[model samples]
Target: MRQVLLINKDPDMHSDLNSLFQENNYESVILDEVETGNEALRKVVNDSYDMLILNLDLPNTNMLGLINKLRLLNQDLPILIYSLELEYIFIKRYLTSGVNGYCFFKNGDVGEILDAAVRISTGKWYISQEMVELIVEKALYSKKIDRFDNLDEQEFEILTHLIKGDTVANIAKIMGVHLPTVSVYKTRILDKLRITSLLELKNIIKIPLLSES
Candidate 1:
């Protein structure tokens, strides 16, 4: 039987998911359920599970940090993100962070969820067709004017840190540079990306993921 570790804070959703898994006839069992990222980490470290269904909105832990930690702990374990967050950027980010599948709760039903679980358990990526089309469209548009390609290594690093909510001083300290130097890098990055402010930069990053129609 396939063992699944479910990490979600909503008791109703948890119960519903558990019931779906049990009734699907997929020979899968929700071996453990965790309400927080810390709890998920504890269970993951101590137990063996075939797959993980993660909710990205866990209150106690940073989502990206937890995903990174889990990837380090079990490189081969399949992780399926079952999240209400349907932002294409977040979906791309999660897949890049080593999640095997994404099931947007807003757009998915029990069938999609079950399919994601089965496909991910078999080492296949599971994403909705609409998401796939959006990714492809964005890829084509990106090839036309790849703004990120213009950033140097340092500028790219600075941009990443900035997006991660790092302050200019913090970035400077982390990069072993003066505050003014980090500020200069940030300015150059903004110029190269063709964006004026951090807010614009964030919005630009999300643009590709936005619905075309």
Candidate 2:
């Protein structure tokens, strides 16, 4: 039997995952759940868990710092990032931090998660083929390029528009969408970077260079 500790806030999710794990014939893997980072710390420290599943959205948690601390605590423990964000750059950040594998949150994807956990526990790497290729490709580049890589097409467009001093209403008009849709995209962009305001990005981001006759 393998002990896999999952650190996430939602107990409902834990129940659903456990049920799925059992239904999918992963009975040998025990899914222990904890809510906070500290609780996860204590659980892993005291017990000999085979693997650790960390949620990126754990409330009030500095994820990278926690990963570093956990890595220092046990160099051999196979840690997996459990995240909902589909952004490759966001996943790469955590994967590079200290995690051995990742399980992106998708409805009814418990089998994939279990597979990743099982593989990593046995000292084998687990990730998508695209991610494997991407890792190799990205290794040659400076990490600064990945800062805004999480943005999708629309979000990037909105970001460029904002850089041009375009208001949300103006962007809505330009994009032929509702003001609320543009507003939501703006919020998602900020949330992705964990910034409350776009002003914070000015130092890190180059001014959008555009020239028109």
Among the numbered candidates, top TM-score falls to: 1
The TM-scores, one per candidate, come to 0.71, 0.63
Candidate 1 residue runs with Cα over 4 Å from true position:
144-194, 198-205, 209-213
lDDT of 2 by residue, 1-213 (tens): 378888988767778778877887877778899888788888878999888888876654546667877988889899988766455545665677678887766664667777787688788878855466666765664344454656765676576566556788887876668999999999998887667787875544532111221
Worst 10 residues of 2 by lDDT: 204-213
Point out the worst 10-residue segment of candidate 1 by lDDT.
Answer: 204-213
- Backbone clash pairs for candidate 2 read none
lDDT of 1: 0.74
